[model samples]
Target: MLSTIATTIPRRALCVRTLPISQTRYASHGTPHYNEPSGYLFGEKPLPQGQKRKREDWELLWYYGMFGSMALAAVGLYYKPDTRYAMAFIPQLLTALIIFNPASKLGH
Candidate 1:
């Protein structure tokens, strides 16, 4: 039935008409203003070339605290007279290493 109907219509009528090219570009409805790049990273300007971004004091403290706690936990677990603690330490260390690795390579 669809084939018969399609055959009755001329090929020109079946073809879709192309829309006229718009000469003036304008933002569509909903957005009131068009945004242009201000060359900023996260609202702040990016660092000059060849300059490394310094870590904040709190970031250093956080990194130290996380690793220090993990190390202390591993030492405690290792010294405890149980096979389970020994078994758990391996996975805990591996998990910490996996999770912590990405933070070191964040800017690259």
Candidate 2:
């Protein structure tokens, strides 16, 4: 019964049909070459290569103020009691010490 059922199914019916496509396709738009600009851009000339513009007085003052503020803030944070490592750990250690105090009369 299995052989008769298999023979009834056509081998050609199992094949898939594919559409025929051309070998080459091209778009109808866009240039094949690039257009290069010939002059300085936007009329603002840049400084010559390997040369840096001198810093203005205001720029120097700004740099000093910014770095000075950062240094002062760092020093302030360093001296702050709450920011100290030992200070942060003191509260937790004190709680534990109070609960386990050797001088307590509750137990030996």
Candidate 3:
């Protein structure tokens, strides 16, 4: 019975083709809006050249991380009498560099 059902089903013909980069609008802007009728078949939307996406859900995290670490470092920098303040300052600065990236932002 299963074999008969399998044999009864028809197969589809799949034809795939590629368009040249110069021929496509995407060549000008790296982002492909899945808002297009057929774009959903592709993957995530890409970042535009020299532009960025945001930290849609991570705004609170970033604020807490950035200013909190900065506060620690800033306090160490000004109030502390010793150069050991550099220790806290360094990690916070690096954290800012890593987390506060181009695409990363405050608020959703």
Which rank order by lDDT, best down to worst?
A: 1, 2, 3
TM-score of each: 0.34, 0.34, 0.25
Error of 1 at 77 (Å): 1.0
Instruction: Give the per-residue lDDT of model 1 (tens digit) for 15-36.
Output: 9786779765666566656566
**How do the residues 1-106 of candidate 3 rate in per-residue lDDT, one tens digit apiece?**
9987676553322234545767545455756644556454444577779987566688888999999999999989888677776886776786777864445466
Taking the candidates one at a time, how many backbone clashes does each contain?
0, 0, 0
Which stretches in model 3 have alpha-carbon errors above 4 Å?
A: 1-26, 29-55, 82-108
Candidate that beats the other on lDDT, 1 or 2, i.e. the better one = 1
**lDDT by residue (tens digit), candidate 2, 14-100:** 565755686544663466455455576744467899988676679988999999999999999888776556877776787786864
Q: How many residue pairs clash in model 3?
A: 0
Candidate 2 segments exceeding 4 Å error: 1-45, 83-108
Q: In lDDT terms, how accurate is model 1?
A: 0.76
Which pairs of residues collide in candidate 2?
A: none
